[model samples]
Target: MPTEHVLPATGPAKVRTRPVRIGVQIAPQHASYETIRETAAALEDLGVDVLFNWDHFFPLSGAPDGLHFESWTMLAALAEQTARVELGALVNCNSYRNANLQADMARTIDHISAKGGTGRFIFGTGSGWFERDYDEYGYEFGTVGSRLDALAVDMPVIEDRWTHLNPAPTRKIPVLIGGGGEKKTLRIVAQHADIWHSFSDAATLERKLGILAEHARTVGRDVAEIEVSTEIGSRSVAEVEEHHALGATLFTIGITGPDYDVSHVADWLAWRDERNAQGPLAW
Candidate 1:
């Protein structure tokens, strides 16, 4: 990517965020609970800033009927198993469960993790996708437009439920909204997310930032307040620096289960440390 095409500082509105961080999504498909648990421990031990599992009931690749695990139940256990490393679903389907119930569950997991150390839970969510996961799991497979509408409507309810929870959450849980849809998704992100995650390249990221910035203005929120997250799984460290310049701070790598190879992560982690040392706000 050309430096000229690099993202503007702090995005369109010039709002800056904190230091760069690394996250890993340990996909909970095609593996046993024991293997999944071990992978989670290994990731935390590898010093990932966050650990994520997708909220799905079936394998996304390879055999369609491969081994898979339930998300929230597994998350509750991970909350107890790991002493550190902020954890959550990479993106939980908003359509599966009731909005208020989701909030309550997030709060419970928050407390569970807090008992070990600082509350390390991120409420990562997305407008429900994956048709098979819905149909087989008994959810109404609504259209994308309907699901986005539901997301927009339910978020307010979810936020309200958080305030009314009995223990009131260990701290205000950070919400990570994933997707790159311009109209509905970006609007929801600007309105509610603490982190906005997307999988796009340098040029595309810059274009998306412009859209997100516009949405932020419409929602009366600072775009910089939401940390930018991107998947760095396939990109080289050199390729990632371009995204860093383009304003992505939370770089995530995906590890499929059964044979979760994370040897590649060490290179990215080293890159993260070197960038952080340059200065608190350096890209």
Candidate 2:
């Protein structure tokens, strides 16, 4: 059974300009652990700000019964291997583990990276999808809304446990929420997420942001406190500007395979630098 989780509320708002962050989701469902590890190191070397893997039991693409790896174990190894670059799942399934255990695991990984610098572990989470994961793992795969309701209840407990845990995370783990359901999901993002990640083209993203802003206003929080991110399907530099115009500053491109080729990561790094050089927006 999953554990109960909660985050303590604080007063006042801190306004921050969303900075462009580029990340790569190293798809683990189809790659060997060694290949995935090397891919992670390669992505770090290529200057990607964040390195991520999806949490799953079966391959999300290609053969359904292809090579696969466990997410947190790989994350622990990644903490030990990479010298730079933040590490975490693109989003972990909230249904698989107790929230307290998740917090403790994150703390341990944070310590693994603490030798040289503050450990970087972004706690990216979402309610479970893929019925196979539930059936095979003995978890209850309820309705989507029920699962999200569970997540909304559990997030605070996870945050509270982080402080009481013996080691504690080396740094505050940025809470990233994935999904773009305007009514419930985006409202949850507005309430609990430090980062909001979704899949959408520019027009769709623009529409969602407006909905998210309404959710934020309803909750009395500034939507700017949340970093906006989306997955890139094409390598066009113009797409970056299009998403940026819609308030998306963090973009992740996903690569999957037995080979884990990430040559395009370099292009994204260059694009990020170019945008930074252009200075702050006129607004």
Candidate 2: segments with Cα more than 4 A from true spot: 1-16
Lowest lDDT 10-mer window, candidate 1?
1-10
Clashes of each: 0, 6
**The best candidate in terms of TM-score:** 1
The TM-score values for the models, in the order shown, are 0.93, 0.91
The sequence of per-residue lDDT tens digits that candidate 2 reaches over residues 154-195 is 888998999898866778878899998888899999998888
Would you give me the overall lDDT of model 1?
A: 0.85
lDDT of 1 at 131: 97
